[model samples]
Target: MISDDIGKRILCLSFNQTNTCLAVGSTKGFRIIRLEDSKTIIKRDEDSQSNFPGGFSLVIPVFSTPLICLVGSSSNARYPFNTVYFWDDYKTSSEAEIHFRFEVKNALVRRDRIVIILEKITYVYVLNNLQALASIETISNEKGVGAISYDKDIFVLVSLSKEPGHLRMENFYTNEVKSGQVHENPITYVAIDFIGSIGASASAQGTIIRVFDCAKLEVLYELRRGSRPAEISSIAFSPNQNYLVVTSNKSTVHAWKLEKKEKSYTSMISRYLPNYFQYSRSLGKLSLKTEIDLTCPYSNITGPKACFFTENEFFIACLDGNIHKCSIHPVSGEISIAQSLQYFGLSSVSVVERGRTWNNIE
Candidate 1:
């Protein structure tokens, strides 16, 4: 009974390209909430027809537009698991869908292209008309761990294998592929910066995250999240790409300062000591207050997903139905919680007044 209940909770969360809103995929449906005031801009409850009746496993918004991509998951899911639905919130219906032979593990969208990731292959298509452009083969990506930069000229990277960490990055415009051996263990999570200048990858060991220069595919920095191993929930770069924040099942979020400078440590020991000794640590970290035991191996909690709402402030959304607005001191590296609101499962009418005038957003 406990397992059944937990399976009906939130599956995942994502922030749009502009970072102004959040798209939550839950067991019943998805919600688009404005981050500034935590208002439910669009809420679609479960519907018997033309909706994700079982629930949404993943929901990604395309550049703060009304168009969104959805993947459904559940035992009773009405939508096929092998398909990706293009939902238009402005129309409040699914505009179109694309299907694959194998079950889709992940999906991503940009202005010009749409990516559907299967276990061993990823297909790229033209967004406007769903024209097949490329089919790239990859190592077993059951988790569908990959990221794409939200720029006119974009960079997309995917984990190459489950062991002996390797990543493959490709620029669709130039059709140039860059490969790099990132870590000794399997890559668990990957993230790219705004304009594809830099990218970060975390290994299954979860102790260290390596940042790379996307153009050269060279290691820029090896950031140490901690000495112990933990499951990484999310990895995100700030809008300006100067900072990175990471969240783990440990119920802690850590922020790190990134420097693009190359190896410049000029100390005497630097020449003799191996690169492991120079791992950069986080600037600050914030622990979440939750009833779920994040460290437990059997805990069914989905953990928290986070993104930078601003350069100095970010929001953490937990599957337990809470949103935490937090801020970090630029100089001191101190993380503080600004406010907490129970937005999940709450009626939209309760948070914002219906009479309030909202600007007609295009």
Candidate 2:
């Protein structure tokens, strides 16, 4: 459904948690693309002469407002400054202006606050009033933080170390640290579902997708893909939490289904293959009741940088600068390509279904 052709390399993308607007980040600057008319309504340009000409790491929509977009950027490493910029722009404006700017080591935006992980410390800024609500020290041997996720009022921080990766959950409001979990390897990516009922994490190896219960702090399921070494590039949960779409360093995407039984969550690999292949050899044919397959209308395509499920449909943003639409059945792990379009410079993608909000109301 992406119609605009503002072809540019996309670094990060996010849809406002509450509205129909989409924010896209690239090497140049951030753009607010409106869904209503398929146009770049608000474009924020980076000043070439400034110390930091807008190198954004992520763009997050304010929880209940679509017109406001939260942008996070690090000061140019070559320069001496280490700061974060918060640019707020009206949807109807042709250009956006900076509303707030703060000096920080690293920063990420959650539903209610902006989490800034510094060189040796971490801080959370409440978005409502722009106040420092909580702060914690990041303890690890590794130089930088890996991934972070926010569920309900709890914030989970994944830090890398020479020994093993550490996962710690903290109550944002009370600043209470919960139990800490360890991973065999460094964590690379993490994502939580809309409801925060389920969550998924990946490691540097990109072989496993660890699914857990956010409320109980228990591992619910795990999905393992190929044997060759590959890093998990992205992970996203379907709107219903019934399916998880994962893309890796290899040109393949794996969809997993979560089955909740009794007191545990189980994961089944629904799809585990590349979208296009030559299919040179067939060993044999066997009787099968049902079969599921997905084929791109075109072949020899690069895998997408990000993917997510919306309303039982799958959307993939390919490195070739295209967004593919497909039909997916979460229960069965079945996927079929519906259509595709070429819109270059697509770095990331996030889907906001017809009716969903950060407040947890349908």
Candidate 3:
């Protein structure tokens, strides 16, 4: 789940699979709303300090007998130094409490446990009863990990820095290290498909989207989207693994088809410029009105964030506190708006499986 507000100042998102939920810590606090009844269940203040305000950089849920949420906090804060908070959401107290804390740069939840990626040191921690059951340190100097996905027994790590991007896969469970593949740009986001055999990566430049094989750790295809120079903020795989949705600072949403026969994607310009005359003249020699419809029925909001409910259904969050749901046709490459809702006091928006539950700390 990806959460963002109309102001572009905050983004709260969580990632979960099977029975676990990963929630990003927020400065304002964490709130869990039930999808079935739309009721607020949990709200807790994320620990913070004067130097580094505390908030979750990322949240990943792990599937086990008892559910666990893997939480990572920003490095700048004083709450803890590059730590991973192991949380059991089933607890009843207001202080949900941290089951375990490990000094790690980032963490991701897998089917059986959690993987913590550090700047210079990499470690994988398996949990049992909210305790670190086993820890494995990998041999690599990884600066940062942006995204992670697992398939079969293999785990893929996407590392980024000022240097070129690197992708590494390892089977610590069985003890195997796949060769590290490198790219020229920094990796922004990564997602593995439902089958876990295929995966994709978006770059900080927002110009390249690379598709790779999780089993082989190989780049099979690369799609170059050259319109925006900003970083790719979010990327998601459609539920059925037929299309990929990507969003960025440009406030535009793009859907790319994965099928070879219908290998194409469409760009939906949901929002149009408010000042047509100014935008027209900025185009230099090109006639803006003739080149693009200035009066099209588009959104006035900017900084749009998006996610998928299914492969064919998606929702986009606007800066104006509105969420627009659209239905996408994979074969036809068409997008149609299905519904819109205005959520009050929602600065950022993210979606998870509808029936998950949360208990408040206070």
Worst 10 residues of 3 by lDDT: 279-288
lDDT of 3: 0.47
Between which residue pairs do clashes occur in model 1? none
Per residue, candidate 2 scores C-alpha lDDT tens digits across 56-133 of: 545555543443433334333422124444444543331332232333433456666666655556666776666877
Q: Which tens-of-lDDT digit does each residue in 1-362 have in candidate 1?
A: 11322332455678887678888765557788888888888777443334555666678889878899987764325776688989988888799999877778888778988888888888889999999998878878866878887778664554464335888888777777888788888787888877877888888888998888887779888899999998788888878776788898788899887765554656556868776777888999888766532111222234688888788788887755678898879897788889987656533221112343211100
Please provide TM-scores, in order, for all candidate models, with all chains considered together.
0.86, 0.64, 0.63
- By TM-score, who's the top model here? 1
Q: Is candidate 2 or candidate 3 better by TM-score?
A: 2
Off-target runs (Cα >4 Å) in candidate 3 are: 1-11, 18-24, 34-39, 45-55, 62-78, 92-105, 129-146, 150-163, 172-176, 180-182, 261-306, 316-323, 342-362
lDDT of 3 by residue, 1-362 (tens): 11222111122444345312223234333434322232334545433323224434444445332344434344224345355555545762222324234444456666655656665445555544334543434333332344555454655544343344666555455455554454566565666664456777765576767777766768765665554575554566777677777666565566667655333332133134232211111100100011111110111112455567676776654443345667676556666667665422432233222243211111
Per lDDT, the best of the predicted structures is 1
Ranking by TM-score: 1, 2, 3
Kindly provide the TM-score of model 2 when superposed on the true structure, using C-alpha atoms.
Answer: 0.64
